[model samples]
Target: MNSAGTWATVTSGISFSQFENVLGVLDVPAMSKNTFLKKEVEVEKVWLKHIDNALVEAGIEERRLAIEKGDVDDGMPFITVIVDGGWSKRSYGHNYTATSGMAVIIAERTGQLLFLGVRNKYCCICDRATKIGMEAKPHLCYKNWDENKPSTAMEQDINVEGFKMSEKMHGVRYKYFVGDGDSSVYAKLVQNVSYGRTIQKLECANHCIKNYTGHLHKLAADKTFPPDSRKLLKQSIPRLTAAARGAIRHCADEGETVDDSISDLKNWPYHVFGEHAQCRNYFCQKVESNENLKIITNAKLLDEITALVSRLEQKAPRLIKNKTSNAAEFYMSLLAKYNCGKRINLGQRGSFQRRCYVAGSERSCLGTKPI
Candidate 1:
């Protein structure tokens, strides 16, 4: 029975009905829905316990690394962490109607999950009772979010909760926060989470570059630009993004000071637009190349691209840290696999949370023995 439940939820995000169908095709008797639900409850308990233990161990490792690296304040270890959030439904960068959302904090040193939180805006028992015009029977309610709050706000709330509980859940303080370009989460942490000191925000290099790429693509698609200008902009996006990424890498690895790094990044646009006067020796070798080889020639288009590069320059200091939320992102991808591509509404019950726990456990225990 336990194996059946694990296969249904952990191995594949299939409903009991689908599981029964598979069993029928195999000429095997299927467990009743009630039995499957009971078994799933047991599996949830086990996975939750495993996640708790993994978090505790991860925290211990983080503290040890902090101490070893001399990142201590007044005898308290301080560590850096990467945070990111994911929604159960696909938003495609616009829609935010997901009924459930999840966020995670991963220690930078150990690359293990330290904490995770989920916010669900649905309850199957209550929904069923309301549909039938009857009172909700006593059952495990999964809804925990306020209906009045927008779904997009769930990530900030979950992140704040994780930051606030850091000290109580783990003995160390999150001195540095590495996340995407969203300032709301960091702002909330600064305003709400009391860590006895300020939390420094570090930008994920990939996200910063991705945002720059997105702006260039947006400009290419805009109707304001002429057809030839748009074609040129579209063709230049790959080189532009590559140059941005290379600037970041050079600044992070080669530059001596923050100002130096920022200056190098700021000069990248000029070098790419055929002005190599400010180009560093390592960044550009063909200073003698003709200006006609420049990809961006339109004055207005040059101004727009320069404006975009300036935005990236403002974030150069953060990008120099070279920190990323990739571990958290990998865990979210694992969650999606277990959640089965948003085809099923797992959040309607405890199934969504249970599946999340399974993913957390898998991520936390990666490269180790199975829990």
Candidate 2:
């Protein structure tokens, strides 16, 4: 029991020493050193194996619950999933790059994690065997690698591989693949898979908003507009994004068709800044006043905003349904904290590093009841 509790603590991003201190402070009787002959190495191996088993079981259980609740059809098993990756350098002087590619299927209606998958290339067999007093063996080598130009292409393949495995093991028939601006993710997922062409790509709205805001920021730096007006325009970027999100939500609530939603979204700029009085649905009360409109008199700034609106309008069909990857972002934050926050190497190049994964999977499974 103490061993299990200790492993659970470590899985939750707590250092082992901190776990001991916490237990000592709480007057909890933890495992004694004699339990395993003080073999820290063996303890970690056993704990990580347990975590891996638990993750697999939790995914299967989640799929079962979703089926029972009719969230996933027993025959179809289709789900909506979000994809993201974590890249970190160990800060060792060598400038090595290690990327952890992750995929998570969350409840479409509730946005809770259903399954999580991760891949990284840190499993060099010769390096491991040499550490354990064994001869180098190339036969045991396995790599989650791609020989494509621009190594980041490997990230797309890893993500697709993980998703496909989830489909096979958990009966995941993904209906939507939510991600950021990376076009490669969509292209890769659609090639050579069962539901590839059927999966719809949903771009994260927060990322889109950030991109628009960046364009606005650059435009605001032009020095042609009045400095005071420039400040107002800079301040308006957030308001613009918020208003656009509200408009999208309104269309979604009204059950607007894709074409209608895109049409409505295209009018966001006019609806926001037009000469309308206190219309109750207006995001800004002062838009009716001429003084507020004059602050954005700069032709280039307004054009940039128009361009942004036009782009969003074109993508409104996708953005109208689900607009954010906030859940996936939250999970990734936990993964990072578990990995390198306390200076632990849990996110190191190999699959044996399960702390980050354990943190994500355990929290997803236990933090909330199946919904």
Candidate 3:
């Protein structure tokens, strides 16, 4: 049990379930704990107790910084926060689920996690305790354990509660919320009195790229494009979108105002797709010119690219809140690993919450290592 628990912390949360698997592939019966599966519940109980202790330690660190800075009421000194949610199945083939929401404060200068918050969703049965006329999810009686709130509520109780806790602890709400264009989270922040003031929304660059390329793939499927041209265009989507973003940034750097930068971004595809392309000025050699590209001269494909650019421009910021949700996504992977790789045990709610708390603590210590 001691070895398994230590291994989990050392690996930043590879669960005890992986212990037997690791030993099976290794020659080290020396480190082997054959009882990991049999003693899983006890091991997790020990692990979770430590996680609670770690959270208290992190909060103390926050308070120490606050006292030193003489700004106990000023909130972790962050104007922006990146927020995202993740969900995983509790068991391999079970209806039970685990959902968590996380928020990370980023330093303006260094862009590191100044603070992190994680909250797990709770499932409960609301008999006569259930509110009348409340629309909850089919499986969940309450959205969360708190006040038996309806399960389908917009800002998920866990996520909003996490933010509210941060505000109380740190003393100020983030001025700008960065996320993957999930309006529900944003809407909740906007509606909250603590966070509503001068709140700006930033869509993640990675999500923006994913969304922009979706349209490109749709255009690629049109039969109007020849097979070869379709292949070329499909391959070009990422390159083209990257170049478009670069152009927008370059325009801003060259003293263009936000409106001008957005205007330039909106008109970028039309100006760059032609033989005498203006992309070379900003994106350099990213835009490849091809005689075969003439095959895509169909007005429909051109219009599709135009619309995509317009949509991209609207979502793409002249200065993003954060470059990507890579940190958030990587942290989610870490959470999964703690839950025992791809297979999670949703059987015990407390166990899942312990995993979540441990993952968040480990993430805080990690400080966004390369990737």
Best by lDDT: 1
Query: What are the lDDT scores of the predictions, listed in order?
Result: 0.80, 0.61, 0.55
The collision pairs in model 1 are none
Q: Estimate each model's TM-score.
A: 0.92, 0.72, 0.68
lDDT of 2 by residue, 1-371 (tens): 66566555555566556667778999986666444223334455664565556546656665776577676644666666677654433535343345444455554445555555555554555557768999866452334543223335545765677667766666657677678888887888889566688878887877877787787787778797678767767777676777777767776777767776665555555445554443334344544445555556444456667777788787777777755777667766666666646355433324224554555655555544432
lDDT of 3 at 52: 53
Which stretch of 10 consecutive residues in model 2 shows the poorest summed lDDT? 140-149
Q: Write the per-residue lDDT of candidate 3 for residues 153-233, one digit (tens) a residue.
A: 413443466556655654444556567766776677657646565567777767876777777888888886667767767
**Per-residue error (Å), model 1, residue 214:** 1.3
TM for candidate 3 is: 0.68
Q: After superposition, how far is residue 49 of candidate 1 from its true place, in Å?
A: 0.6
Residue 292: error of model 2 in Å?
3.8
